[model samples]
Target chain A: MFGLMTGQKIDRIPVSPFAMGYAAKVCGFSIGDFYANAKVNFRSQLMAADMHGYDSSPMYGYASIGAWEFGGKIGFPYEVGHGAPYVIEHPVETPEDVDRLEIPDPSRAGSNPISMEVAKQCNALGLPAVFQVGGFITFAGNIMEPARMLLWMIRKPELVHKVISKVLAFQKLTADWYIDTFGPEKCMVFSGGATESNKLISAKQFETFTLPNEIAINKYVLDKGIHSVLMHPCADQNANIPHYRKIREECGWRGRYVWNFGPETPLEKQIEMFGAHDIIGGNVDPPSFQTKSFDEVIMLCKDNIERGMKNPSGYILMPGCELPPLTPPINVHAMMTAARKFGSFE
Target chain B: MNEEILNGLADAVIAGDVEKAEKCAKDSISADMDAYTSIMEGCAKGMNVVSKKYECGETYVPEILCSAEAMNAAMDILKPHLKADATAVPKKIVLGVTKGDVHEIGKNLVKLMLEAAGFKVIDLGKDVPTEKFVAAVKEEDADICALSALMTTSMIFMPDVIREVKRVKPSIVTMVGGGPLSAATAETYGADGYAKDASVAVKVAKDLVRSV
Candidate 1:
């Protein structure tokens, strides 16, 4: 994984199934435990990585973090169709609530304690620990209803900015705690940004709302000696490419950063937009693992790997998002199958 | 005066100015203009421009939402005045995000756009159980049943929901939308229709309603 992160010429390009709850279910563990239980989250992912022979580390967080962490209800994955924990009720429902909101102390926040416990496990075992700082825009939405956040952008820009600043502080301070505890080399900052995508806002709005926090967090972690960042710019963000370019110019570590794109933006376009230095991570449609047959999935993986292999810095073959919790193992195996067959440099 | 007020109302919705839209709606009422004309000519026309901007990538989700608020504000003023004989509700759709998927940003946008296009929508809300969707279809006698799912995980339930809806009422058109869905996937799931975005959803709903 480090070899892939450092852009070395390894024998084969690494494959990550991008499993979360899928990993838990794969290992006969409860999907709900994957989120609320630290040991379960770590052990399930570790076992799944070992079982599938995929080349990624077990991760410890979910995209829907802020609402729960900042004082709201969060639902664990108890149902067959649930992939990750979701915000059941946002902390700040009304504009008035925004004024009263407080950023929980990092050491005792909603799920940070669980997150820290998971990181400690990874650190003691010499594993690549993922420290999650969900993108500011998405986190802001997690704290409040997303539609309310967007409407606030027009009617109450100041209120929106207020929540964003508080959330941004929570993210940065949480990063500080992780880095202070485990040091940067042991932790790879993983950013998942669903709301930052153009699906919710335009590129200009992205520049206004998401870019500053992105640039700040990248620079912050880099300054503290973190060697890697895996940024999942979730959903269709073809239009936000131009604004994303600014982060590259300002933060300065193209090779160390891996930008994962979904099917919304073509892989080739992402490669070109990201340039020749940063590692690019995906393009495989996650839905295929549930819908397509094994051979069909292998074919898709091969197509993605071949396109990604052409990237100058490096490429990692993985699904664009978390695999469906019920994704078939044969289809999951197809990813490694394609990686071994077509991704070999030997 | 009615022409000027109608045009101004369109401008307010397009601008996403809720206060102005309400004022325009009130002005139309004071003028004693046809309330149906105020909706068909005023607010919906403005929503049309907002949808076009979305297609061109000139607008964002918040803009559409703000526009919806403006239109709905005007609607609150104009709806009661719509003469029963003149107001012919286009079609009714039962819409919600699929079970186990709580994300409803996409579903909400589609509902608003469907309303803008004059469809009477019965929103079932997010994380809706499959049985609830089927029940809604039967109870409302909905022309179309739309399901949304943001995760590959929850999207697996779509085909089953579609199947059950069809099993319960074969005449109802089933449609699906979300981040992970596509036109092909929709067909593969046996959906009668699909739309990639809210604006396109409005267009798709129109065609599906006509077919029904």
Candidate 2:
């Protein structure tokens, strides 16, 4: 079981690129169809993942929906290549507004509930399922208005902390539910979003606001005897492995974890630095899945497999970020074919 | 403001202190200094330093937006005095988050920099309908409309906005910029120009406005 959870040895280093709404696009289904018909969506994802010999499958849930369901008016326009939905209208306007915010019912309101139900279905079907939990910082950033959040972080630091407290409370409520129902250790994996890519915020700001929350979540999840994967898909070329190591150590988690590496990530270097405990996944450019030929996809996946095999103890092959929405199914298949050919069960 | 005071303003901006920024600007103005020079030379100059810090990854959005608000407040006091001197407006541009897209960091940064450069910016808030953009163009009698969309899906709305603008006023130059947008994609969408960042957007907007 080459999964973020379980921490089991693999039959071979597996290929698992996150299907970020790409399943819908590749299957030519509407969002309504994708969400409404979980069985159909599940079949397509299983087919795509298996075609690639992928270790696991992923399904789409709106990143902003958790916050949006909690009274934030977030939305995504139906279109080609929108990627993920983001907050459009903020529900909270004043410091007093935090008083009015009610924790959203994850079983009812937004895609979180839909995703949870689907997770349950997937689990019952004996499919490995990863529940996408909002990163403490990113979710906090999304719930409040981005512009206003920025303003409030400075103009009202105390208020920002208060809002973050509420976000954490709500997030924990949902996370606790998932863990209790699914049994954290057996549930495929729990992934969270603390995108400390230096592109969006400074390393200092990341250290201050992002890292603490990430560390908190890591402890919370790991304390439950579950694994936590930190997704930092920011476009910061300057980010190094030492910071990641520091985060992992500071989080006090001795178990295995995965880092969602992106284009700028030096996988070999990171392997050298944090390979002892951290498993590096992704670095395949998402757009390449759309723009490249099947041969190119095969070569890319082969290269990743070869690289991972160089240190099979510390690598997971996958796309750098969420797979682009327009990624071709053939490319995905080719990636799986290559992985099966070159992978080892070390 | 003296070098110490200017440094304080710089520190305030870096720390995102609006009140200290306002107080520093007022104190400098009361000290028999030219308001424009005090602003352009004092506060705006400090912000440019902060912007460099931001570029170098020394500051984040919270700090930057707060600093921008400080600059905005200081500018409010200094704008009237500059108007008395018949100050030049670098460009007159209309800006908005494109229809169906609402992420505003890049757009807001572009607006901040444009305003910092003395452009009269008409900022239509997020989720702007195409008609609102067109109406703003006609009403503001704007020279350029700068559109932004953070998501690739919402980037489709940029072209619709350009078409709406051209359909009503063919001569109006429309510039689109965002994470998902590139010059090639912008050309594919029939945009007049594209910028990858705020400074680039400022330059493009200035050039487009000047040429138009």
Candidate 3:
């Protein structure tokens, strides 16, 4: 039976919705063993999730190279526990570089199949999983020269727009393909884009350069009548409460903005600011969880949940960013337990 | 010009009101006020206010950039008049985002602070390749070349940029900064200087130029 809740529909709000490699490691498995065998990885993560009372379980934490599978030579460690995938080599260097890069045929080449496989495994387990999708700018930008990407925004705005349009088309196409393959009603699409945050580019820049692509993607999903969630993980120094509010106002398409702490975003305040939204996720410091004891982790999770989960407005207990691969499994479970025990605000 | 025009110019620039800024600058010049005074005294003061607002978290990136744009417009109005024999208060530095890194907030901040502190900065913008950086140093005949990268993957290319600069002209001071960089890391990468913050970057630029 699905555990039921009133304040928000989540019967048991997901706890530790981050990379699961650390969980597998803490549960006593090798990294190679976990990646190769989803069952082992899933078992460890589910054990932690269930013990912690998590309603939903996370799949791989850092499959950033999902975009690189298109043709970019992404540096591997493929999942640096949960950090952004490193670009060992870029596929696009010049205008001609874009020519060499083809939007990866997801079902065929990269981690796309692995993700679908994991989703199926979760479905078979009678649990729900969110399919994570990467955005065009960060993925494509990373593969191209970084500085050039910014200049491209300035000098070759048209070219950058062309590439971004192509990338977004791929993202939407891939998401649709996943839904059609996996059955849309059974699957929820979780979209991610960090570059759209105000840290790297101004709101003007975001509006001019990033927002169009974002709007297009969100529109694509919304047009399908599918619930598409957006996770914008930016810790820009200029990222503040009002800016967060503005982004949500501008880009919120019945989905939510998953936030991270930055120089400007105080962890406690972010929870207060985002409490009104039904889909706010994060603010726990992963490093703290990695280093702290279960009790401290419990306290941290409890504090964030109390503030962040005031009313179901959909709360996801997660780290502010990538859950460092070294985080303790007990700590993660404790976080989940706290969320389960105390996420109600009726 | 009255305080209204001067203050308006400053406020318009800080507010990123380009039209109002241009109007204010032109009004003051037509009123027989020196364009350099309007710029250094009015526009610079406005920029300082915006920077302070930024420091206090009152403004975000869009606002800061808009303010920078307003200031830039004022600069455009005043540069022609001030171009004559402008004495270098501090040595000129060339700045850019490193190869493969498009993150530019920190780099832009450094550029503003360096200019505020009286150093001429030739910003090459973000994601600059090694060749462009090398060319910038030679073209500007800059005394220092500053580089920045936000991602660890891209920051790895910072050393290569520095290497190319040294290869072209080893005498040019090569500096690097960003979230992923550490002082130890900068030294390891053969950079002459490392700064963690924009204000500190200005001081470092001044110090590097002085020593050079």
Candidate 4:
């Protein structure tokens, strides 16, 4: 993956099989422990990575991270067929509640400490300590339920902005703690934007609510001498690309990143709009892992590799999002098999 | 004067103005307009336009939600004046986010549209179990049971709920929708209908009611 990132010649393209609960499900571990216990999540992901031979490392995070981190409650997966952890009650209910919120210590809040344990495990193995400061707007929504906050975009936008600012503060505090614990060179930042999908919110809302904080996060992370920053802009984000283009001038972009796309943004269009110089990955429909057979999975993966190999910078293959927990095991391996068989330059 | 009041109510809803919608509804009652026509012709008519605009990508969730609020506001003001015939034999539908999923945006949108279209929606809220759905169906004598799940892991439970509901009462229709599901998946699960989004869900439900 580093070889592809730095423009080095490689034997074949790398594959990042985005696994979370599928890791625990395959490794004979409990899904609840995977999210609640840091050691379990790291080990489960590492075991899955080893088994799949995918070019990735274990990272401790989940989509529902911010809710628990910011003084809310969540329920971790306890049984098979249950999804990832989810927030039970948002901390902020009414507009008045936003003023009453406070930022907790990153060292002790929610899973931040457990996340550090995963980072320690990574650092011990000579891998980068990855910190999850992704999803500012997602966290904001988690603090005050997504639907309520989304309505506030029209009804009470000031409340939404207030929550976002508080979230931004918490994010920076978390980043500062990670950088101090492990130097920037050894730390990788993982950020995502599932809530900002055009399916839910308009691109205009994305620019107003999510774009500035993301720009702030990128600048803060990159200026710290941290070279690695990979983003999985999940779901319908084709409309959000122009704002991304706008940030280059605002942030003095030191762009050497491989932006991951989903089924919404076609591989060709991302390459066309973002340019042919940076490493690009993904657009593999994630549900295919469960719904399609092995042969079908390979055909879909081979198509991704063939079209993705065109850009000069390079290509890596990955699931459009985290694989569904019960996705067939054979399909997980099919991505690597396709990469090995069809991704080679020779 | 009746046409003028009804048009005013529809225009307020289409414009997504809660204040105007309330005023229009109150004016319809002051002029003694039929309550059922005000809802079906005025408020629902405006929601239909909003749904079509959303289908064409001209508007989005924020605007759509506001429109729903405007229509709901008008309905609340006009509901008590409704005649016995308009309230008679409204079909009941039990809706929920299937167990293990907490996401409710999709389900909530569908519920709003269903209620606006005159269906008696029995909302079971999030992370609902299969047995609970069957119980609701039997308890309410529901005509349809709609299930939603946002994640693939949780989505696996859809067929279980569908099968159980059918075993208990073979005549009840089952509907499913969410991020991971398709029409093929719904059919495979023995669901009578599948809607990709909330707007389409209304049409599918109406069709399912007619077919049954």
- Cα deviation at A66, candidate 2, in Å, is 3.9
Q: Which window of 10 residues has the lowest lDDT sum in candidate 1 chain B?
A: B83-92
Q: Backbone clash tally for model 3?
A: 10
Clashing pairs in 4: none
Estimate, for each residue in A1-346, the C-alpha lDDT of model 1 and write its tens digit: 6787765668988888789878988899988998889999999988999998998887777888789889999998888778788888999988889989998899999888998888888888888667888488888988987888988987888898899889888888998898889888888888877888887798888888778878887787888888888888888888888777778788774438888876677878878877477888866998888888999999999999888888887888988887877889999899988999999988
lDDT of 4 by residue, A1-346 (tens): 8676666778989988778888988998888999889889889899998988888888888888777887889888896557688888789998788998999899998889989999999999978798887566677888899888888889899999999988888888988999998998888888885787777788888899888988888888888777777777888788888886665556565757777877768888877756545677777988879988999999999999888888666788988888888888999889989999999878
Q: Give the residue spans of candidate 3 off by over 4 A.
A: A1-14, A28-44, A50-53, A61-67, A78-84, A99-101, A228-230, A237-277, A291-299, A333-346, B1-212
Model 1 lDDT, residue B67, Cα: 88
Scored against the native two-chain complex, candidate 3 gets a DockQ of 0.09
For A223-276, candidate 2 gives per-residue lDDT tens digits of 777654544444443453455567678866466676666656766866776677
Prediction 3 global C-alpha lDDT: 0.64
Which stretches of model 2 miss by more than 4 angstroms?
A1-13, A32-44, A47-55, A76-83, A88-91, A99-110, A227-243, A250-253, A288-309, A328-346, B1-15, B27-39, B128-145, B156-176, B181-194, B203-212
Residue-wise lDDT of candidate 2 within B32-77, one digit each (tens)? 5667676666676767766666666666666778888888777676
Report model 3's TM-score to 2 decimal places.
0.60
Q: How far in Å is the alpha carbon of B48 misplaced in model 2?
A: 1.9
Task: Choose the strongest candidate by DockQ.
Answer: 1
RMSD of each: 1.6, 4.2, 8.9, 1.6
Binned by DockQ into CAPRI classes (incorrect, acceptable, medium, high), candidate 4 is medium
Q: Give the total clashing residue pairs for model 4.
A: 0
Candidate 3 iRMSD in angstroms: 7.6
The TM-score obtained by model 4 is: 0.97
